[model samples]
Each structure stands twice: as C-alpha cells, then as structure tokens.
Target: MKPDYELLVRGNNLRLKDDFLGMSNVTLIQGPSGPILFDTGGYISRLGLLKALDARGLKPADIPLVFLSHLHFDHAHNVDLFAHAEFLVSRREWDYVGAPHPDDLLVPWGIREQLSKSRVTLIEGEGQIDRGIGFFPAPGHTPGCFAIELDTERGTTVIAGDAIKYAKEAILRRCDMAFDEIEVGTATIRNILDRADRIMPGHFPELVRLPDGNFVWDEAAPFELMVR
Candidate 1:
C-alpha cells in the first residue's frame, strides 16, 4: 500500500476575456520527498497560486518536483516560482515546443520559452515520478500532453491534462481545439476513463469523481459510465 499522502487542489476559472478564460485546476501532491506540483496555472493565476501555497504552509521554493501535463501557458506559466524543483515533462512535448507551429493558438510562445530552465527531465512514454506515482502519454490536446497516475487512499486517480479538459468534454467526446487531431483527443479521454476512478482535469472547477462518494459533482448532473 502507498504511504499516506495528501492531494490538494487549486482550481478556479479565468475571468479574463482575451485568453481561453475558463476553469483551470492545479494539484499539490505531498508525499515522502516533500511536495510535488502538477500543472501550475497560467500567467494570470500566479498571485492566487502563491497565496494558496502559503495557506498550506508552503512557499514555491519549497517544492522539489513538478509534473507538467503539457506546455500550455494556462497550465504551465508559473514554473519558475518553484525555485528548487526539477520538472518532469514529456520528451515529445519538450521537442515539439522547441519549434512549434505559429498557427496553433493552443500553444503560446511564452510558455514554451519557460522550458529553458535547467533540471528538466524529459520523460519518454511511461515512467515513475515517485513511489506509486507514474505518468503516461494521453496526447491530442497537444502533441505531447500526458496524464499522471497517483495511488491514493480512495484508489487510483488520474491527473488528465487538457486531454479531458472538463467532464462535459469527455462525456460528449468533443473538443473545441487542439494541436493534433480531434479523434486522438477523444481516444485519450476514453483511455483515462478506463484507467482511473477519479480524475484531476485540467480545466474543471471540480474533479471528475467516478463511483460517487462524497465527491463534489455527484449531484450537479446525472450521468452513467460503464466499466468492464
């Protein structure tokens, strides 16, 4: 069994009009080796993210590892703040952003530049970030987007990036835009649903909790999912 761990969520909707102003979620996983940050939010969320960390008796400099779901600015802008952390990013994403097409608005220029910081480990297909925590590709939202697998007291949880931005998007099997093909995005979503009982989505105000416990979304909408 995995040791006792804490998963704290820092989620909110971006009210700004210029960007893809909507729900964004970041997760703080505290385990044996200090704290781990998953997808620190966009350029505008720095203040709130910092404040949230402070509330938990943590400062950005205290973080030692960061797991980036993708290179989207909305999900990866405040990386520099985690002063002592080593970032684990998908090698596919690292290379793609090294020279991305200017047309894909899903990827902005600034966030890609942020990868210049050292100590970044390029994770290939699948690997472990720590004990009972692993990662694998769940692409389509971006050429190299991936999801995190965490073993928790409640069971297994998947931190699916924008691959399944919201539960609504996953339920509908649809996407508004992405770096690659739409079909690929839907497939990635299905894969996550197949593997995890709970999900930490990239842009959802609440987690996509399955099997209905004391989860936040158990009442907002009636939905059904069959697992084989």
Candidate 2:
C-alpha cells in the first residue's frame, strides 16, 4: 500500500513559556516507499509520537528512516524508539553527539550508546535522498544542524529543524536561547529563506511562505503573515 505523508503537531512544551518562544514539533512523512520521522520529542513524551503513529495505522518499525535536526535532547531524545530504522544526521552533528561533554548533560550516556549501535548515516552537503526528498546542511543552530527539503505538487517545503525555530524568528533573524551562535544562525536562516518558498519550522506552526520576491527578513508581519 502507498504510504501517506503527514506532519503530526504534538504537544507544546511551555516549561520556558516565560522565557523562550519555542515548542516541539514532530513530523511524520509517509512516502510510497516507507515512512520517515523527523526530530522525535523529549524522552518523557517519546511514546507520544509512537501513539500518534499508531493512530495512523503505523508503528516505529514502519519508519524505514529517521532524520534528526540535531542532538539536543528535546529534538532527538526519542530516537531510540526506532532502533530498526536507519538514522540520518549531519556529520558534524553526529560528531558533536558522540563527543564527550561534561558541561552539558542534556543528552544521556545511554542514548549515545544506543545511537552508536544503530544504523547511522552521516551526510555532508545537499543530496537527494529519494525522488522528491533531499537533505541539506544548515548549520548555526548547532554545528551539524540540517534541513530536509521535499518537492510536492503544492510547492517545495523545507523542513528547517532548528536552523529556523519559528517563522517570526526566521523572518526577523531572531536567535533563541538554544542557538550556539546568533550570527551563524542568522546567516543559515537567510540561506533557507533565499531558497525555499514554504518553510516548515521545527516549532510554531506547519508551513510559512516567503513573501513574493522578498529575500530579506520582515519584522513587522513576522509569524502572523504565514501562508498556513
């Protein structure tokens, strides 16, 4: 049976509601070949994605491949759920995840060990994963943060994980607390806005379009002016 692609918007994390303007978004893309999951939510809500997939008559095993935007716990904590799937991530991001870091313990040792055993594919630059799907490196949010581009009948949709958190942040070049560097994140967001017509940010809504012929970020009508 041909698989159906869908983006499942899970629960919103309001822990930092007072400080950061960010939420967790989990994407479910069911292609003709198989299903692909993007950025699993935190460990606590890991099964939440599985439940969502179950509702669609799919399971973690049905997902042949999984792409992670980065190694941050919030974005990749539930990766272990798909042990049978080949996990893809940016080469730089993989190294960062494997690297020993005593300062930050957000990523647990068990998760890293599990990842080491899984089928991990490290990608460099832009490359076509399938007929209409492609992966591109969009560092800045993290050293190896990347985005997934899908060509559809509607238009080209870029699933920009953390490279561009919110539509408003992308338009205004606004960096959140999770970004490693502001300048790099800003440049990456600019690169995405320059290429993609519609952007599916990791957080805040599904897709936002770049106003006709506008390459620069617009602060006035940031998130409110999205294409939906």
Candidate 3:
C-alpha cells in the first residue's frame, strides 16, 4: 500500500496574519487501511480547517486515527474535532502537560478531557503506528516532542514536527532556535535529514533533497503520500 496524503498548509499561506509568529500544518493521509489525520492545525483555524477537510471530501468522524506531532495549541487545537478517532500522543509529552513549566506555555489544556477521555496510545519512542506510518522521539519544541515518518511514493518522508521548525534551520544545524530542549533538537534534525528524502516541517516550507545532498524549499509541491 502506498502512503497517499495531502497537506492542509494552515500554518503557511492558508492564513494571512502579519503578527502570527509561526504557521501550523495539518496532514491527511489516506492509508491503505484507513484515513489518518496528522496534526489538527491551530485553534484559530478550526472552522477553516473543517472547511478544508470538507473540501477534500473528508470529515473528522471519517478519520480513524489522529497522530499529533506535538501538543502545541497551534498544531493540536482541532484534535477534539475528530470525535471518534483514536488519538496517538507521546507518553513523555503528556508528562510535561500534567506538570507544565513556565516555558512550556503552549501546553494544550482545553482538550485535556478529549486527550484521555477517548482511546489514546502513549507512544514512548520510535515505533510503527501502522503498516507504513512510524514515529520516534525528537524533543525540542516540547519535552516529549516527536516526529512521524511515512513510506510514500516519493520515498521515506518524515513530518519533522517542530524538531526542525524550518528547513533553513535544519541546514544550519541550529538547535538553539527551539522552544524547549536545544541540543536534542539539533541532533534530531540531523537524524531526520540523514534518512528522510523529504521533510514536512512544522513551520517553514517543506524541504526536498537535491541530487547534491542539499535541501531546497518546495512551495508548490503536493505531497501525494502512499503507504505500501
């Protein structure tokens, strides 16, 4: 089965807000087994996100699995929207949420009940959630920050989450730019770059590798994810 997918680039050009510091992206993966919703976009874009999904002939109820990159409000606000989908979160991530630090202000509190009230799987480290979907710890933006990987038609593509917020930052190997852990962030970026053919970052433009082992931003690329 090929990993077929589309990105609702809400964090990028979807909204026009000069003051918005960063953008959030939500992905819809039409897996062989079922539909997978990756990240729920932002709270402010709830209605827009729903419309976007409707435009694609999909609904939150139709999604069977909801995988979150992290629990940041911008990327996780709409999680509760998928009333029946099973939510997958990092075990370590919830630990921080259970006891948030001052710096970890992005902790999602509104959907606290939804997070655990439904069927939730606490992913610890790297493991396969489905046939072609996998995840591993890549903390930086948050304590239990993680990223999701997919076996797509393009190759091994990874949704790098906030681990490498921007493709430019990945090229620089800069971890100091993250919100939480710094050193681990840089290492995680390197780790993803070394393996993934393409990376859909959390904030910046998606990055595809060139023949020269360099990455360039692709603003027009449509991620047709297919999982085999």
Candidate 4:
C-alpha cells in the first residue's frame, strides 16, 4: 500500500528575530505497517507536535518509526519524546551524532539515552522503505544527511531536509549558514534538484513543483524574492 504523508511545519524561519537560520519541518508519514515521523523539531516543539497530533485524533504512540535527516539541534532535539518508535538514520549521520563533541551537551542527553534503548535502524545505501517511499544519501548539509523520495498519487515528492532549505537556494546553489562542508552541501543541493519533481523544503511554507519542467516558487514569484 502507498504511504500517506503530511508535512508539518513545526518551526518558523525567523527563529529569533535576527536569526534567519533554521529549517525545522517535521513530516508525518502513515504507511501500511504504521506511522513514521521525519525530524522531531526543537526541544520546545515536542509539545506542539503532541498537541497537533491530539487535535487530529492521533497519539504519539501511533508512530512506530522516526527518521532524522541529520543530528542538528533544530532537527532532532525532541527525538526523546518518541520512546516507542524505532529510530532510522544514515550510518554516517549516526557516527557524526555519536562522536564525542563538546557541544553535545547542548542537546538533551536524555534523548541520546533513549535512542540507545530504542531499536535504531542505520540505513547505508539507497533503497525503498516501502512500496513508494524511498531514501537515498544526500550528504553535504551533514555527512549523513539523507533525502526521501515519495511517490504519491499526486506526484513524486522529495522531502529535502536542509539539502536545499529553500526552493530558490536550490536553484541558485546557495548554501545554508550552518553547513559543515560548503562544497559537499552545494553538490547535494544540485543532486536533489536533478531528481525532484516536487520539492518540499524543511522550513518553507509548502511544496513547490517544476510543472513546466522549470523551477517554480510556491507563490509563483521569482526564486530570489521567494527565498529572501
């Protein structure tokens, strides 16, 4: 069966007035087996996700799997909330997240502890997670960052977690401020644009499609202003 998915915009672009530097969107994918979530948003976002699920008549326990695009605080800070779900992440990303870093304290250690007990699935290559949902390594934004390609009834939707934060950024080849490696990030952005028919960025408003075989912004505006 084809998976049903919904992109939940968890955080805002302007995180704190002057910081136009975060892309924190959580994707909820309901498959034949069970529900799966992509990215957990920031620490404060856990309650918001629970409340949103509650309003929709769903519960956190309903989610059996959770995938992280990367280990950045803005993307996976609330991972500890899904205690019952199996966590999926790229092997490279897992190594990066698990590596000894002085800044690790910034993220809740509880989350890491929970992860240790939870069933963690480390993806190593491009493959299908389900009939129509697939994952492929798109390193650069982070060593282990991966992108998802979902073949939906509407079209093929690519959930680009920070590989291409904004549609315009993908078009112009602009890298995010927090990228660990700029060259790798740019290459990943290009790879995404090459394969995606519809692009749903991490913190952007909604999906944008290349309807006429050309990059189109969500508001039908020019790429520059749309990203700005």
Candidate 5:
C-alpha cells in the first residue's frame, strides 16, 4: 500500500538584508513501520514546527524515524526534538559535517555534539526505506544531500531537499546555490527532472511535471504573516 504523506512545514526562500529566513520544508510520511519525518525545520521555525505537529495530533516521540537530506542548519538542526526517533542521515553527510569548511555557514556548529545524544543511523547510496519509499543520491548543495522518492497515488514524487530547492532550478535545469561544482548541481537537477513526476522541493511550493515536459508550481495555500 502507498503510505500517506503531508507537508508539515512549507519551506520559503525569503531573505532580508543581513538576515536569512533559512526555512526549509519539512515533510511527514507515514511509513509501514510508523511515522517518518523528512527534514526537521531550523530554530526559526521551532514553535511553528511544534504547532504543526500538534495540529496533526502527533508529538515528537510519536515519530519513529527522522530523515535528514543533508546537514544544513535550515534542514537538520531540529533533529533534537525527536529524542525517541531513530535519525537516518547520509554517511557522507556525517563525515562532511565532522570536518566542514569554515566558510560553510549553513552547517550549524556543534552538530556532532548535538546528535551524539541521539540514536543515529547512517545511510549510503540508494535504498528503499519502505515498500513505496526509497532514497537516491542528489548531492550538490552538500556532498551527501539525498532526495527521497515516494510512490503515492499522484505518481512518483521526489522530496528533493535543497538539491532542487526551487521550481525555477528544475525548470532551468540548474542549481543556483551550490557548495560543490556548479556542473554537479546542474546534473543532479537534470537527473531529478528526468525521473520525478512531481517534486517536493526544499524551500518552495511543490512542482508538477507538465505533459509538455515543463515543471510548474502546484496550487498552494497562500503564506500569511501578521504585522503589528
């Protein structure tokens, strides 16, 4: 059976002067074993994340597995919330984080110390996590960045965390932000566009593949903000 899924937190690419929004999308997939969460949001979305979970009638402990696409602060910092869940991270990611370049500011400091307290499992290469859910390498933004593939009623959806952060990237078939070689990131984007019927990007609304072989954003609820 195809497991159910939901977008717990819709990611955004908004940034302000001297301030980065750095909000990545968080997805919840109901696996055969139990609830599996893909990429927990950063500290900025802490309360919003909790409220999102509560709205779904779930607690952090209720999640059995947490998958990190990479070790970016916007995507991986909130892993601490799920104390009881087993975290699935890329083995390559773990190694890279251990000796990240000083200029990579998106990688939070003290990651090893933070995750040492949790039960973490390292993943390598492509593999299936469940019957309809699997993972494949899509590194670019980070050396170990991986994207999750889900077989849903809508067809194959790729949860491309930062690998294909925006629809424009997929549409352009290139990555705008790449810590690695730009060609490597572009290749990853092309690979994703070639295989995925739809894409749940890291920091943008979902993208649907058109019959004409073009990718366009799906209709999503409007983002709201309150001003005093």
Candidate 6:
C-alpha cells in the first residue's frame, strides 16, 4: 500500500533586511510501518507544531521516527520535542556539522552536542526509510542533504528539503543559498524535477508536475501571514 502525507506546518520564506524568518516545512507521513515526523520545525513554530500533532491525535512521544533533511536550525531545532523517536540524519551531515564552514550560520553552534544525546541513526547513500519511502542523497544546499522519495497512489513524490527549496529553484534550476558549487545544486534540482511526479519543496507549497513539463501549486493557496 502507498503511504499518505500531510504538511503539519507549511514552510514560509520571509525576509526582513538581513534577517530571514526561517519557518521550514514540517510533514507527517503515515507509512506502512507507522507515522513518521519529517523535519521538526524550529523554535518559532514550536507551539504550533505541538498543536498540529495534537489535532491528529498524536503527541511528540507518540512519534516513532523523525527524519531530518539536514541540521539547519530552522529544520532541526525541535528534535528534542520527540524524545522517544529515533532520529535519522545523514552520516555526512553529522560529520560536517562538527566543523561546518564558518559562513554557514544555519548550522547552530551546539547542535551536534544536542544530537549526540539522542538516539540517532546516521544514514548513508540511498536507502529505504520504511515501506514505500526511499531516500537518496540530494547534496549541494548542504553537503549531506537528503530528500525522500515515496510511492503514493498518485505516483512518485519527492520531499525535497533545501535541495529544492522552492518552486523557483526547481523551475529555474538554481539555488540562492548553496553551500556547494552552484552547478551541483542546480544539478540536484534538475534530477528531482525529472524524477518526481509531485514535489514537497522546503519553503513552498506542494507542486504537481504537468505532462508538458511545467509545475503548478497543488490546490492549496499560498501561505498567508497576519499581523495585529
């Protein structure tokens, strides 16, 4: 049977001068084995993340697995919430974070120490995370970034984290914040676009690829923000 997915917290790409409001997507996947929490949102979305799980009749402790796309602060900061789940992060990422490039401010200073306290399974190369869910290296945005490929009733779906940050990156085949060579990042984007029937981008609404090789938002309206 195919797996089912839901975007627990929609990612937002907002900027204010030199600051970026990093609200990365948090997703829940009901795979054949059990429910998997993909990419725990950061401190900014902590409360909402808890509420989202509660709405689905789940608590952080109820999650059995947590798949981190990478260790960027916006995406991995909330791992502590799921104290009982086994985290799956890339081995390359684990090693790279030890001495990440000085300019890669996204890698929180003490994240490695935090992760060491948890039960983490360092993934290597392409492999299956669970029934119907396969993962492969999708480097460039980060040296060890990985993306999920799942078989759904519709077809093949890719949960492309920062490897394909948004629709623009997929469409234009470029990255705005690449840690690797720009060509490598663009190449990764091209591969994902070619392979996925639908893409869950890191900071954009889900996209459905058309037969004519174009993509459109998947029935959901763009994210909205409200200020009082």
TM-score of each: 0.83, 0.81, 0.88, 0.83, 0.95, 0.96
Each candidate's number of clashing pairs is 0, 0, 12, 0, 0, 0
Candidate 2 total steric clashes? 0
Prediction RMSDs, each to the true structure: 7.1, 5.9, 5.9, 5.0, 1.3, 1.4
Candidate 2 has what TM-score?
Answer: 0.81
Minimal lDDT window, size 10, model 4: 219-228
Q: Which stretches of model 6 miss by more than 4 angstroms?
A: 219-228
State the displacement of the C-alpha of residue 200, model 3, in Å, after optimal TM-score superposition.
Answer: 0.2
Model 2 CA deviation exceeding 4 Å by range = 1-4, 11-13, 17-23, 100-105, 210-228
lDDT of 5 at 31: 73
Encode model 3's per-residue lDDT on 119-193: one tens digit a residue.
888889789877888889888767778888899998989887778776666788776555666787878888988
In the range 43-115, model 4's lDDT, one tens digit per residue, is 6566778887788787878788888887777888776677788888888877776663453343344455667
Cα lDDT tens digits for candidate 1, 1-228: 462333344454344566555635778876565678888777667887888888988888888888899887788877878746788888998888877756666565766456666488888888887787888998887889988888888678887878877767656667655787788887887787777767777766445454543223442322233599
Ranking by lDDT: 6, 5, 3, 1, 4, 2
- Native-referenced Cα lDDT, model 6: 0.87
lDDT of each: 0.72, 0.71, 0.77, 0.72, 0.87, 0.87
Clashes of 5: 0
lDDT of 5 by residue, 95-181 (tens): 998887666788888886788788999999999999899999898888889999998888889999999987779878988888766
> What local lDDT does model 3 show for residue 12?
56
Which residue pairs of candidate 6 clash?
none
